[model samples]
Target: MSHSIAIIGASGYTGAELIRLLATHPSFEIKALAANSKAGQSLGAVFPHLRHLDLPDLVTWEEIDFDAIDLCFCALPHKTSQEVISKLPKTVKIVDLSADFRLRDPEDYRKWYGNAHGATEMQEEAVYGLTEFYREAIAEARLVAGTGCNAATGQYILRPLIERDLIDLDEIILDLQCGVSGAGRSLKENLLHAELSEGTNAYAVGGTHRHLGEFDQEFSALAGRPVEIQFTPHLGPFNRGILATAYVRGEAEAVLEALQQAYAEEPFVVVLPMGETPSTHHVRGSNFVHIGVVADRRPGRVIVVAALDNLCKGSSGQALQNANLMLGVDETAGLMLAPCFP
Candidate 1:
């Protein structure tokens, strides 16, 4: 029997991507969709791209009877997500695509987000949903907190090296180029086509971006100390990917070997040959992540590059992957399609 599911915030990009993936999943059925503002409208009306799928019309959250849902994907915004998720029935599994429960400490959540965590008790059991590194814990978790797209891409490049103690942590730097969609479906003067297209500008410069909190938490926890990296994200003219270039103090060969050994058997992460760099176009619209490494001309320096679709392996695709593990289904199910190319 197919596991029945509910998708809250179905009108957004990540939510729509979840519907796109779950539409073809063999053992999952989307039984409800909630987009309060778009309530009573057909999914087709909100997102014409998904018009062909036989999906439930968007409804308000209060209208759904949670008893029928075997799993739920909470794609709502930060504060909103915690509020809604706190009210869910404990029996239903949840995969939260927001930043609400990603941090293990309520104090860190408050320090970074500037507000108290609405669901402090819930944070106690929310597994970090990076999939590859947290697979075992995710399989046993009822609530999984999805990592930020930028955070995930950077981790794919740095986590292994940190785990192996192969790199100088104090000198790590991550420079990222991200798609505008990572900003979300909301309206912003800067995101307008006429303004964003044909141009590239760096936001979150000088270390103020919210995703830095995730990096600090994950990397620090891995290194058994506070490890901070200089991170700056540039908004590219493209629509759906993140390309991160990390500069670390390590030998090129050692960095390559660490990355290769870590993700060799993983289904979703691929490491390119030494000296070869990956492009966002290669992993666009797919659940795959491609990583590359190169030795800098200066001794004791190396560069690692990682690319992935911000919407896929980054957010919604990640949420679906965690949902699969929680449901005891194949981790690759409904997410094995090849990337879209020109």
Candidate 2:
């Protein structure tokens, strides 16, 4: 049984990444590719790298026949996704790659995104698509919301420890560095190669990053208390990947054991050997997430580092992982490509 799929906002980085992975999927077919500005253009015109595949010409979302599409992957921007997805057919199973539905509380959405959620009903129904933690829920959901790249990397390292009460929640701090692509395909003066290359700097500093909402929501829910961590994000010169280093107060061995046990059955998460750290280069361009735990020189302190492709495991790959459950296909299908290395 082939599932006919539509990808909205198919001209961006994440949208192109979804096409890259889904192009090889055995049970899924790309039926519609929508990009309002790029409508009527061939997909290859906007994304030359994808020219090798046969794909639908870019169309406006309004021109799509949702009734014929079994699934939809909404890769639009934050506010845009909410507006577009609200108008989509109810029968379509959607995996949204935007922040529109990731947070549960509408108030939280407003606080972070600076506007009222356009689609509260769908917001209430969206399952958080952090595949490992929300598997069963995602498998049954009609709309699954993908997690933020930085949020995904940080959660992979801390969720298990928080769940088992292995770490001191009060003292946790997440310092993450991400490639420029995670900022999306939009053009900004600061993102220009002349400005960003050969240099890196932190933005959204002092607990100001938007992904803190996710950290607060997920970590607090797991610990059954109000948990807040100091989060700071930096933009690196590279093109892809995220490396999140979490400073935690706990026994190193215990942290390693907790992560290993929690992700033991997960197909995409790998807990590297104790004391060995992971590098973003190792997990580049793949759906796999690599986590490493090591002891800090100070007693009872440890550093947990997690690495993954910001676009893959952090967004598109995770969207597909949830889609597999929603479509009742093997979770690892079309996602077995090995990490690229130079």
Candidate 3:
């Protein structure tokens, strides 16, 4: 029952994470590790923490034998993912952890990413990888697109409300605080320790963030109309997790009821008791989502908050979840590890 797997971007944060999770996986074997820049380097050299896993050394994607891999997790950056995945063997199932195939329309992809999609044919069949709602499709999909960590956090709180008509569509506002790791393993002057510690600043203001394409596509489709939400994302000082606070117009009881009902059977999503709020600390390093609902002081207003590890549940862990379904493994396989907490 072992599924041979390969990671195309093995030197990045998400790639390291996939190796960490798959290290203890019951049915998945890491067959190849690809990182073009780090080619010929051992996984231990690029990632000291993973030195104990005995995984394959990093290599160029072009050198991989796709015939030997059952599923390939493409952890490359946006534009690069589409190009690499489009050229991958059609026999291998793929779980893409980039933003490449998330948007179904090439026009939407171009509008947000400022480039034409190189794999429109693949996009047409790529299933959205929000495992809670898209599980069935993912189980049957050959290519699955992992959602943005921020987008996943927001949708976890808002999707049920929108679907059940529990919230006012026009009044929905999402304010998120994301840890630095969500930016990936890339280096930037703004992310320097001295520059980011003990401070917080919002970026991508005025609906300019790329993840808005996800919200626009998902929310609008759920509501059967063009539903636009006011979303603002802030870069936090820490290294993991995402906390999203959603402001909406709705009856607290009804909204809470809808969320509780929506996630009642979901394994990874947890709906907390009313009046309790979640913290990014609780769900860090795990494929778990904690959601809390609180009634606002103003009548007809309620606040919904969700917390998850941007690296785990929000990305790599999410990619692994979909890969399991696509391979006919248990949905929660290799994903039951408890959250790391202080």
Candidate 4:
């Protein structure tokens, strides 16, 4: 039985990415696409790169018949997703690709987003959609919230070590570099070709990045106490991908063993051989995360690196992976496409 799916914000980068991957998905069918601004236009018109696939024309959210849809991917902007999702049918399983529902505490949401959560009841039920960490919960959830791309990258490298108690809790530092597409498909002066084309710079410095809320929530839970890490994100000139380098004090062999043991059974996470670090190019355009660990010259220090396509494994791919679990389909069914190579 094929599930009928709807994409609520179908004109954006992540929305297009979802369509690209789901075009070949075996268990789900794209039944509707909603884009308020681009309504009545064909998906090909909005995203020329996706012209190769057959998909529905863009429609306004009000035009979609939620009664006929089994699952919905809410790809709307922050603060907007909660408002949109609040009005959807209770029976519709939703995977939100926004910052709205990722934080569990409403206060935290307001702290990071600067406003109260419009839908607190639903927020309480939303399972954080870090597929590897929250698989069982996601499988049983009616609403799943996708992680921040930067948050996902950092967690993939540190979560396992933190869980195994193999690293210094207070000494973890995450330095991440992400492609511009992670900013979304909106217009901005800084994102223009003239400003972002020839150079790269870091933003949200000094432990101020929003994704830190996620790091605090998840890492704290794993350690059974409050855990904070120094996190900084850099904007790279590239189009897509995220490379996170984590510095910590731990035995290199133990860190390697912890990561390998944690992701050994995971379909989407690949723990590369010891002493071999991953590159963003290696996992480009695929629903895969490549992680590598190596020893630092200084004893009791190690560097853990993780690479993933910010749009794919970090967002849409992760969403689909959770959707598969929620919908009772094979987790790896439509995600077998190999990463693109240069």
Per-candidate Cα lDDT values, in order, are: 0.95, 0.95, 0.95, 0.94
Once superposed on the true structure, which residue ranges of model 4 sit more than 4 Å away at CA?
Answer: none
lDDT per residue (tens digit) for residues 101-193 in model 3: 999999999999999988899999999999999988999999999999999999999999999888889998999999999888888999999
Q: What is candidate 4's lDDT per residue for 49-105, written digit by digit as tens? A: 888878889999999999999999999999989999999999999999999999999
Total backbone clashes of candidate 2, pairs 3 or more residues apart or in separate chains:
0
Which 10-residue span in candidate 3 carries the lowest summed lDDT? 48-57
Find the 10 residues in a row with the least total lDDT in model 1: 202-211
Q: Over the stretch 53-156, how does candidate 2's per-residue lDDT look in tens digits?
A: 98889999999999999999999999999999999888999999999999999999999999999899999999999999999999999999999999999999
**Candidate 3 local Cα displacement, residue 111, angstroms:** 0.6
Q: What is the TM-score (0 to 1) of candidate 1?
A: 0.99
- The number of clashing residue pairs in each candidate reads 0, 0, 0, 0
Collision pairs in model 1:
none
> How high is each candidate's TM-score?
0.99, 0.99, 0.99, 0.99
Q: Least lDDT summed over 10 consecutive residues: which range in candidate 4?
A: 47-56
**lDDT of model 4 at residue 147?**
97
